[model samples]
Target: MRTSSTIRTRVTVKRTTRAAAALAAGALALSLTACGDDDKGDDSGDKGGGTKQPGVSVTLPKLDGESLSVAAVWTGTEQKNFKQVLTEFEKRTGAKVTFVPAQDPIINFLGSKIAGGAPPDVAMLPQPGAIKQAVDKGWAKPLGAEATKELGENYSQGWQGIGKVGGKQYGVYYKAANKSLIWYNARVFENAGAAEPKTWDELLNTAQMVYDSGVTPFSVGGADGWTLTDWFENVYLSQAGPEKYDQLAQHKIKWTDPSVKEALTTLAEIWGKKDFVAGGASGALQTEFPASVTQAFTGGDQPKAGMVYEGDFAQVNIGETKAKVGTDAKVFPFPAVGDTAPVVSGGDAAVILKDSKAAQALATWLASPDAAAIQAKLGGFLSPNKSIDSSVYPNEVQKKIADALIAAGDDFRFDMSDQAPQAFGGTPGKGEWKTLQDFLKNPKDVAGAQAKLEADAAAAYGG
Candidate 1:
């Protein structure tokens, strides 16, 4: 890919029934606890008025005397920050709110619970695949027209339409991490007399030049089988644009398209040169994700390494372990390849459940400008509300990324695996990813790989 962004693949979203069965088999259950009167307790005092607003609302027959609960994956210091927000929300609404902070695996647990007929009113999911699973099983409720109206013009059309599966709105997304950009060590490129490339061919030349200098151009771990997939997605995007690929994911287009072959051919050329990727192909397959990132940031970590393409979330991890942005690091858009336009991939949506007066209140609150500000401060995400200013970004790099995304216009889209069947990652092992990576290793074999992928996708889609 031309720019420094890494495309990611969401894992196979197991079949809806399987998700339900897994939920049932796991016995994932939650019990509610009462929150005694705090300043944030119900303000209405009217028997029913007590049922609405900010904090814990325990009015449903199943949760009577219980408190309003919100479950999400933010933990430790982040969780503490979220709780502080909840406390402030409670103080403002007099609603008793309970925050159930959990771990990543809990998504499955939540999915299982939802399958068995219970789900958290809200969750802070970092990805979209699980939400797709929830919506597919009819376990999620659309956030509705009012919520959409409230979203105003604050976000991009891509973010607004991300949750609308099969023309029916399913969930609201509030968290997002942009992945169509690359962060690199400014000093390394400067010292190497290299400039950031804006087009695919230039990028390849840069990679080869860096390799010739004896430094690896990229650091990645393909062992998990997911790492190599990132490069593939970006390649597909640069070659095929969004709408056509969306059709491909929906089984409306053939994987054997010339565009697909071109994308795969590009990846094969890179993979064929053992010196391009930090570790050769085999070494890449054995490396670990976090460690590979660490290697990218080591001082003068060039010729051996100069750049790494990843999502904005990597900034947090990098901050925690290495240098901060603008100083030790900087990011640029993934370059446009061949005749393709610049493209970006990331951003999430928000879905509302419950639909009670309180739920409606919460949805309204989330879709408000004030809510977007709070999310910026607390969640570190770009708000979907159009009224919010770009000043909310934490750094210049973020602002540049956002500007690039906005400029991308219709070219902005989500990764196809995020738009495909859940078995996308598992059954096919690498699914479309393997096809692209394999083709990169042998471009002349493109037709065979293309045919194989089409067959696999057809079977998966039951075409």
Candidate 2:
């Protein structure tokens, strides 16, 4: 399944229904609508009197009548906030940029477009593997000097390296996700008298306390297999360490390796305990990602589960409930299963496909702090750009997430599954996704799961 991106919010009460409704409508190719009235004033600078625009820092060349099309999987509030960023670019540079909604596995969508000679001028690729695929197919363009400079100045070396293929920079990572978080109901934690856990043993103790308080400790979105992959990735990254994580992602190490077994065994501790999970293993298999979030935050003092695990984007679903984030709903880092806590992240990278002056300019603009600040303020967004101040984010929770990501810097790892081929990692009911879901249903069968995973991965990786 393609990872869905949504806006993270500070105050999401009013946006709850609209945001959910937009997501439910699916990733349709919605046309660009006017975000707000465009200023007819001087397009030179500072349209808001003499005050600088929030995200406008670099000077852009005049593209008076230039038109460009950009494609991505973002819809709903995510698309809306991004359009706001595009709107600012339009205002400052006099470019006509259109938002083209592309589906997941965006490379497939771009393939047909490239064949038809109608590819978007630019595309926001969600996975690093997709970026490589685009380049391998000779469809991606290298970043211009300006964009390259912005990337060096604003982003960490780790993020910059993710966009590079064969020693050349081909992408600008515009949006980021902190995927190793566990959001829980503050009231449930209070009722159980459980404190935030810092280690694997502590986490289990906390879970037991919540279970003892008559509430399930965790909500697993088992129906969506990607959630299951995340569960594995966090444990694997923390326990086996980054070296082994990369080896497995590249298929240099087999899934049946002892390190893999160790990770699965660790995960089984939670997955095996049916009483520790909301609705048990069978019911969890029916619960989708959205429902998992709602189950944790919907009930007043006794929600279905005390916690849900996912990226910061879970806050979008949490918004659908009456509970307020950072108060009623609070988050903690995924506890350390090994010597250190895991920081597995995912992000969207902006790459030029149909290179042009306008397209390159827009690509360079996105690399600047000016462009990031716009969406950061709109909420439900985080940027890897170190140049952007934490205050740009709408709430402290988001600020902390952004801080953690930047602090990890070059030490952090991208989502392990995302770095693998789509057939092995991104597909919905196959490869790692399916294998992990089956493992979730039968946590004790670590060896069986490892065998199945190795077979599928070998096929996908052409071993």
All models: lDDT? 0.53, 0.76
The candidate scoring highest on TM-score is 2
For candidate 2, give the lDDT: 0.76
Model 2 agreement with the true structure over 274-358: per-residue lDDT tens digits: 6888888888899987789889998877999999888777766776788777678888777778876666556788999987989
Write one digit per residue (lDDT tens) for candidate 1, span 1-463.
0011121223211111223222211221111111111221113222334244443222211223434666664544344544654554454455666776544333565766667766666654434665666666665576656566655345556555666667665555444445555666666766656777767788788777666655788866554344555566666665675566667657788888878777877877767666777767666666555556656777644424677765554554455445556656666555656444333344434444445544544554555554545445432244444555555555555544444344443334455665555455322244665664555445578789889888877776677
Candidate 1 residue spans exceeding 4 A from truth:
1-91, 94-109, 115-118, 124-133, 144-149, 153-158, 165-168, 221-229, 241-246, 286-290, 300-304, 352-360, 375-380, 404-411, 425-430, 433-452
TM-score for candidate 2: 0.86
